[model samples]
Target: MNNFFPAVLRLIAKLVILAIAVIAVAVIVFWTPGKPADELAERWATPPSLFMDLHGMQVHIRDEGPRNDPEPVILLHGTSASLHTWEGWAEHLAQHRRVIRMDLPGFGLTGPHPREDYHITAYSEFVIALADSLQIDKFVLAGNSLGGRIAWTTAAVAPERVTRLILVDPSGGYPLPPKSMPLAFHVAQLPVLGQLMDYMLPRFMVRNSLENVYANPDLVTDELVDLYYDMARREGNRQALRQRFQQDDNGHEQAIIRSLEQPTLILWGAQDRLIPVANGYEYARDVRNSELVVFPDLGHIPQEEDPDQSLQPVLNFLGLAEQR
Candidate 1:
């Protein structure tokens, strides 16, 4: 019996060592750091894509549709997302109204902010600067997730400039942290594990994060994953995200929502595990002129998940829809 126990223990130790060795090899094979912004821009930034020097950073922006249309709509993408996220919406909306979208600092091809500022207020200011640079006096603002938070804040600070607001699962006023977050995001929140992400990122991790946020798991295709993965590896992008995660949460949620007087549309995914649909109701109640639309089968990013279905209500709200 004593000999049997010793033999089993030795076998277990060998198996453990072999497992560790396999993992080490896998890490070495997949330790891809990603391409620089210049290289990615070659493929990602095609025609109609323009880079403007704003706040000392080269901002990637796309202005589409009718330039003469007043109150041009400015679309803001969420954390880790690029202007391409609005491609579907911009395509349709641009037909009637001028549509503008940009890759925010620390995300997409914009990489990181020179000042290393990722706060909501900083984003708000960046929006204003972008608007000023474009000579836009008044415009309609729409955003999803982190972009939504910036939209509302900009309205509060410069109500005269933001004629209306569209918030799609905004983040500033989350009653609580998301029920579930992407594993990469969870890792980024950690003190030590986050450092490892700065140096190494696995394509599977990006794929996993995309799948988690989407209502349909199958939407996380290879091309989609490649877009996110390449952008994340863009120099300084990962580090900027880490800084953003570490920043203090902006408080006074109710007050911020209450202060909004612009006609508002609150869009949410009922199945959103990130920011629950309940938040859409709270936003509707607080904003006197606001209307909430919840997608029963959608997740956090209904806009991207099903743009055709999600954008119809927005078109109606903006009075841009063709009358039947």
Candidate 2:
């Protein structure tokens, strides 16, 4: 009996070693290195894409529609997302209003901030600086998720510059934890895994993150995966993401949000597991001049998930519904 037990232990040890080997092989095979922003820009940056020198960074921006429009719309994207998230809305909105979207520093073709400062304040300042560079005095500011937080912060700090605010599932209203966080975000919070992410990222990780945010997983196409994966792998972006997450304050600036004076439009995805619909209610309650709209069928990104449906409320708010 003693001999049999020893043999079984040996077999178990061998099986464990084999499993480890398999995992190591998979890791090596799928090892993804970061790509230079120039390489990614070829596929992502098209005609409207302008690489302007803003605050010492070659900011990748798309300025469309009639430049004569007095009040243009500036669209900002969420964490790990580029301006492309606003493509559907921007395309339609550009027909009437001047529409501008950019890859915020630490994401997309814009790459990372030279200072590596990813605080909400830094982002707010960047928005103001971008406006100055564009020579735009005042406009409607709209953002989603992290971008939404920046949008409101900018309005609070520079109230005169923002005529209207559209916050979609913004993260700065309440200090509520997500019911279900994306695997990538979870890893980014871990010391070890987050560091490893800087060097090696798997395609599945990007795909899973996108699927997690969308109400419909099927909408996450291979092309969509390619865009996200490519942007995530941009040089210095992964590290910037890590820095941003580290510096993130989960709604410590509720005072700033409550202080917003611009006419605000709050949009939330009812199916959002990241930031619940309750936060949306809090925004409507806190912001004196705000309207809240919840999309029952959408998740974290209602604008991206259903731009047509989500844009209707925004159009009405902008008084462009009659034009439609």
Best candidate, TM-score:
2
Clashes of each: 0, 0
Estimated TM-score per prediction? 0.91, 0.93
Candidate 1 on 213-284: residue-level lDDT in tens? 998899878998888888898889889999998874777678877999999999999988888888888899
lDDT of each residue in 194-281, candidate 2, tens digit only:
8878878888899999999998999999999999999999999989999999998765667877788999999999999999999999
CA lDDT for candidate 2: 0.91
**RMSD each, Å:** 3.6, 2.9
The alpha-carbon lDDT assigned to residue 120 of candidate 2 equals 89
Residue runs of model 2 more than 4 Å from their true location after superposition: 1-26
lDDT of each: 0.89, 0.91
Which candidate comes out best when scored by lDDT?
A: 2
